[model samples]
Target: MIITGEDIGKKFGKTWIFRNQNFEIQSGEITSITGKNGSGKSTLLQIIAGYLTPSQGTIYANGDQIDEQKHHSVFIGPYTEVIEEFTLKEFLNFHQQFKKPVCSIEEMANSASLPLDKMIGDFSTGMKQRTKLITAFFFENDAIFMDEPTSNLDDEGFQWWKDLLKKIDQRLVIIASNDQEEIKCCSKQLNL
Candidate 1:
């Protein structure tokens, strides 16, 4: 699979996030988008995920142009990662209701070390992020776009995330973060 962004640019009022930003991300590999806050890290990701219309340019995921109205991309941005107050089981049920899979949630949870009995509202931020990532691993999508993936992860959890990315197949993992460790682990870098 191939994800190509050519001369991608975005603007909010007079604030131009970035212009002529380009990248060609390949399948079965991880790529990091690095930049400071307000430098368009999240904006660039949102544009790729088809959440926002770019002020310029276009993108193609797996050789097809992304449709902004459709939920083709698995967008795991910070604001939409998870819902509050749902128990882990309930959350899993909600997530699976949209996509049927070969393995059960229990199997996925066990493999990812996610808790099933705890309330998400009571879980730590890192745990919450892990739960989201675990859901992403099971989601039905060709690509996964993660914004600040290591934001809430602890050292161990971060390592788990790193190792897990190395094993996924057929899916493109595009991460937006400033984390050095994550950047090092990725095969390519999309510097914003």
Candidate 2:
């Protein structure tokens, strides 16, 4: 898969978050969007994931224009919502209805060290983050977009995140973060 952004820009009201940015991201590469706070890294990632529309220019995936409703990418971010009302098992089952995971639900739960019967609402921040990562990494998708992936993770969880990345080395992975350790794995970087 290839994602191309041509003169992409985003603005809210009178202020421009970012403008005139261009990039070409391809499969089998881990790309990091690096910038300081409020530097539009997350905004740019959202635009690429089809969660938000750019105020200017265009974004294309594999030679086709990106459509918000039809894009087949998986996104995991601080703002990405999860069904807190469902148990881990229930949530995984529900997710399976939309997209098949690369692994079984039991394997994902075990790898994340999360109890299948536990409600997502009851999980700790780190656990929830793990759940999110597991869902994103263990799913079948052409592209994966992550924003501050290590936000709530501990040292062990951080290592787990890095290890998980190794398993999906052939997929198109895009991350928006300021963490040096997290960015270390990326071969291509777009600094805002």
Error of 1 at 30 (Å): 1.3
Candidate 1, number of clashes: 0
TM-score of each: 0.89, 0.96
Per-residue CA lDDT of candidate 2, range 1-192, in tens?
A: 899999999999999999999999999999999988998999999999988899999999888888733655789988877899999999999998988788899999888888999999999999999988977888888889999999999998998899988877668999999999999989899999
Worst 10 residues of 2 by lDDT: 64-73
Tens digit per residue, CA lDDT, model 1, 1-192: 677898999988988889998788887778888988778988888888778888999987766787733443477755774776888888888877886553687887776677888888888888888888876777676778888877778888888887778778878888888878777877888876
